[model samples]
Target: MSTEISPESAFPGPRRVFQKLNEKPLRDDLIFYFAIVAVASVLFMMLPLLTGETAEIDGLHLIWFLVAGTLIVLVQGLITGAVALLAVSLVEHFFLLFVDVHREFEQTMKSTVYALSPLILFSWAVLLKIPFAGLLFLAWFCLSTFFGVRIFHEKSKDRAVFVALATGVVLAFYLHRAVGI
Candidate 1:
């Protein structure tokens, strides 16, 4: 489709997200918050990857590693968070700029909640499995529902699921590269 959303018709959620963080240095709030989360996650994930089974460590080295790992985790968390926010924001931005929302915002939020239910359920199910890593699409679908609803306001159905899946793939690929996966 042409997807020519007028500034007025474009979704409101994305506009709000952008407006909230677009102040003072442009992306300070987003970068800082997400960085902390990413760093923690990265460090935690890295622990299982370390080898030498029960290798002894000096007090200083252990401390340093902890600090360093924490930093990386924070970095990753922040980046990922920013990317997540950006994904939704971009969709909203486009919609608001090109399309019109005939429905109300509250309705959109409800649909998003429903659509995201599956992803959350799947993540909880696959959190520590022997594989099926690709199942993350379930979570992405769930998340995208939230955004889709926010932007489209219950106008579209499964479209949000696809959007979420696409967002997940993009995020995973970029993160793998950024973290040297």
Candidate 2:
């Protein structure tokens, strides 16, 4: 794990980011996670206009679009993050009660955010008009959650796997609704 943390290096790629997430501090992952979300949200908000027919907008309209789009994306990202944190935390809290695994709320939140990387990409794909992107997103989401939960419960691999799968199952519906896919 690299101690030098920056959004670029910390989130160099999905695979690298997920791997580093297991080794890096929660604070660093939180920064990187939000940065990625912000960038993704902005790009997602721009996709329709970027991919659609060009529009005739004057300077004022263009400026307004940029400013309003940025604010909307950031606000949307914050709301989504809050919801995800609550959902993931609640799920983790519930499962932890049944299992003997010892982990903190911060750890669960960090892992959940990192696990959501694939879903973010899926949303990008949806914005880009990719075929069957929703299905792909679901697959990626399940795998990411499985491994993410597994990382925090190394003591009992069986229980970890079960909890992870359950998390995936429960989160799939919530995510599908949240992403509007």
31-144 per-residue lDDT for model 1 (tens digits) = 453444554466454545463443367778977876776677667655665555555445443443333556543333333333333432343234344254434554455465
TM-score of each: 0.42, 0.75
Tens digits of per-residue lDDT, candidate 2, 1-181, equal 7677888765576545456667888778777777777777787777767777546787899889878878988899867866766777678657756777577777677767767755664577765557777667766665665556666544366776666667766766666754345
lDDT of each model, Cα atoms only? 0.47, 0.68
Model 2, total clashes: 0
lDDT of 1 at 180: 31
TM-score of 2: 0.75
Off by over 4 Å in 2: 1-20, 53-56, 127-129, 176-181
Query: Candidate 1, which segments miss by more than 4 Å at Cα?
Result: 1-46, 49-56, 91-99, 102-129, 139-152, 158-181
